[model samples]
Target chain A: MATFDSENAAHLHRELHSHLPSDPALRVKTLESLAIERGLVAPQTVDAWVEAYSEHIGPKRGAQVVARAWLDADFHARLLEDAAEAIKDLGFQGSATGHLKAVANTDRQHNMVVCTLCSCYPFSILGMSPSWYKSAEYRARAVREPRQVLSEFGVALADDVAVRVWDSTAELRYLVVPQRPAGTQGWSEEALAAIVTRNSMIGTQRDLPLEAS
Target chain B: MDAIHDLGGMQGFGPIPIATGDKDFAALADWEKRMWGLARSGVAQGVTIDWFRHGLERMVPSDYLSFAYFNKWCANYLMLMLDHGSITLEDVKRGHLLAKEAEAAPKSIDDVLASNAQANISFEGACDTPPAFAAGDAVRTLRIPPPGAHTRLPRYARGVEGRILAHHGAHAVPERGAEGKKDYQALYTVAFSAADLWGPEADPRDDVTLDLWEAYLVPA
Candidate 1:
């Protein structure tokens, strides 16, 4: 449960592993201060961009899309046909969404996403890719041993269901539309959106539970 | 050919560590934020993502693994700015802009965000040749490593057999993209059985699909 920011600092300090000549923090601070002090960028502009990513964009935006798709058949159709345009309906458009392709999970097929080479996620929509998603372990095991990896994430798939691991190695970002849970046929979009976790949307965990266990 | 960044199937790295909530960024020191902002600013100044990535790839393996992610971003941004003539080494070393000619016009917040959106262009580059593989066609990735300093193809995916899932049209070749070339190559999602990729230890019902370019594939 360690944040990459905190954990990475520890990693940087691990002299046994790191060969850094000085604290990386000092180097970055020097560069960042220089960039702002010299007017290469304004402090306010950087703050705004960070605020946009941390607050404006996130799994909730994705949950809204998922919930609407579950409620309206046509919206679901649109989502499958052209995800980039469909997502734009909710006013979520940006760099990370370059040609998004949504793959729905069904009774017979399950979808999971990983970027083995690098963390090429739709950050503009899904917020920051989780630190784990960027970890060397998740990147390596997600593709080579997905079922095992999923099990570690607490997703136990049925043996008969085929699991599709999408290695997002290009500009195409994937959104896994997990199967709608049973007994939620008439739920409101707001109600459904409450249950969709970021993990479920990424296919590492199951869709929102029907009534919170 | 195989870099530390190519971590797939490598052992010893343990389970994923999970961190919840918005506090993730709170862990960022002020410098990391500046590093990120500077990189985005570079992008706004017309530096291509592929080109920036190529700059990061140019890092020596030790530095690649040792430097924190944002530190890598900082180092690469400095190198690219110097290489692209956006800034001189004196500007970086002195921690201030020394030349009137070196100053890049500061972009507004809206302009920065808009430029970020525009950078996410869809597949628009032209392809002079027809696609070499079709959906449902069996194809095997060539065992060759990427010819350049950077590539999207992971090491584990090479020499594997898989079925073409879809033809995503001719797109700018990633290898060429890294080299600042606008060349096009056929791209497809090829699906390999987990068992095929990892032997019987893998689940029989699982398939791993990767988006690979035409230059990386051949008849199975």
Candidate 2:
């Protein structure tokens, strides 16, 4: 179809979000169209486009690391104790855990994350942040009432488990490192990665599965 | 903690900002010649062998540095240009490729942002204010588990109510803000004595103020 640059690209990108669909898949299509319109798909722009795509789709090579850690205890403890080191074990690359402690989601208290100030996420593990993750709305509200924010995501927590909202401060940014879900008793990395949506890695998603049409 | 640049809040209170927009490339060619805190010809502390320390402090009230991220996005785009040999930092300074810098010399970083390509966002039914709180009021953080969100309420501070300190401006809603066109919604700061948000183990005199919105407080 139409591509960006020359003149009309900015107009297309400016309009892409205006009517974004609720369906994540549909949203991805919308972004792709915008990228094309913006001339982001030119052969010269392939790297940038690939980078954008990876940011959205290629994330969770980090989650796969987390999943493997869930399968192994010594690794799990190491991950909880020192996320940077634990992550290095998986040969993943990122910036958030270099100085700060990376907290893992547990059975006791389900965890969520956000860069209320900005969109500082673990792109190494989770890939590109979902469009919502970068928006100012989530950034501002995620910190104010984390529970309510999670509720909007359809994640309702029971009263017992305490919530600890962590900020990805300048000293050290944070990553949720969500717990692996059940049902896939002996799934491999590929299978798990398929189900391990980017939202799950960011802590905005929950265990609920999408119903089949 | 600190503002992105040194000299604190004021951008051009004392020093007249030199135009680093175009002439910087030639100046940077002699960057190694300039003694910017380095003892002699060596690299400054806190920098890698190749990277020099600019000694800038990037900070704001909110958690992540949006400006830094924005700068990062710009820098990456520039790097992409560099990789393709599309333009040099000198070209960037010369106002050759940049649509924004072609104007008068940018006085400061803010000036640069003003000059460059701008992207504006529109919010639908966006609530800029969540009423029911004021500065110097007492409040507490609700202890609700996050199903799937990256939140800021520390576990140690759960159910811990803090007093409302200076109400920072309303932040954009992040869920929508994440869409990237500047969705900084409304937000407020709730102050908690480090002792209260933490515990008796914390310093009673030390206060811990958090930038929060009305949704977190249940009229504590």
Candidate 3:
């Protein structure tokens, strides 16, 4: 029986598919790096592979629906009601999270999301994850010290606004649809897209004012 | 519209610590550094592919995201002034520049990766998978614990019986707990009536379904 052919090995091979290398050298570096990541290989090859893979993937796009939602109230509602389908219409599948649900953040309340079991997230729409967001520290502390966690992200809730934390259940990967900012009143789609940061939509960061055109 | 982390500021909780040393700044930075170090180290050692890259680590989080995150701190006062037309971008710019410099470092690519969960999976759970269990059938949740799992299945669900409310289809295993390996995994929703999962005290109307792995169940 081949040790690298177990169920886990298959999974490893699947994760391996996500890798991209610009050249032959980077390809070797990436495989070597992953072996060390799983504690399979030695330490000397980690950085080169990381550098290669890191260069392959781009910033998480977040949900394009956040921008769509900002413009379309009905779609926004649908995103809140059924995040997966609403997003699928936009061609965003929860690749990271096989299934998904959306949570919204409002002025009266702020929402923070975490995967208690492990960093369950909706990557189809949100994009590649933040390292800290998936870290054990973020997961363990987010629930126990939520206020502190929000504070770290600089989300200061008022006395009236509530702060809610969602501990990811086993089946669902969740993301945040932040409230549309007031200032983008007449901004065009492209303009609105400029101000929509990935973290803001994820509810980890807040919205910034659009520069006056 | 609530985030999974929106549970703070509830009435039952005590007064939260404010500005507590950058609000666990040391810990957060340390956590990222560790992940960064380990990930980089893993590559340095022998492991090579990371399914994704985090954003901040990839590109500088534009001035916009910087304000989005940092504004939640002590800057609220200044922001309110600017919002009410009390201050100009010029006024804030000077202070902002200093703050940016102070806060800035070699931008990381951590946030460039998936903000949501991205598990590596092979088998595609066809949308139209045939059902093994029906809504009315009484079923039990399988309790096979895979190695390296920090699962949420209560101990009671291990050998207990519940009805199969729905067949959720084949789902890719959650890659994180499985150390980033996910494959064609069968998923089912085991509906434990409030009373069934807990006891008679559980409310009859407030039933919940446990999204379970096929490995976690057998017929009751």
Lowest lDDT 10-residue stretch of candidate 1 chain B: B18-27
- On lDDT, the stronger of 2 and 3 is 3
In model 3, the runs with Cα more than 4 Å from the true position are A1-30, A33-60, A169-171, A211-213, B1-150, B154-220
The alpha-carbon RMSD over the true interface for every model, in angstroms, is 7.8, 20.5, 19.7
Q: Is the docking of candidate 2 incorrect, acceptable, medium or high quality?
A: incorrect
Which lDDT value does model 2 have at B161? Answer: 74
| Candidate 3 displacement at residue B162 in angstroms | 17
Tell me model 3's lDDT, rounded to 2 decimals.
0.45
| Model 2: residue A53 alpha-carbon error in angstroms | 5.4
Residue-pair clash count for candidate 2? 58
What does candidate 1 score on TM?
0.87
Please tell me which predicted candidate would have the highest TM-score against the true structure.
1
Model 3, docking class:
incorrect
Q: Model 1: what is its DockQ? A: 0.31
Model 2 segments more than 4 A misplaced:
A1-57, A208-213, B1-220
- Count of clashing residue pairs in every prediction: 0, 58, 75
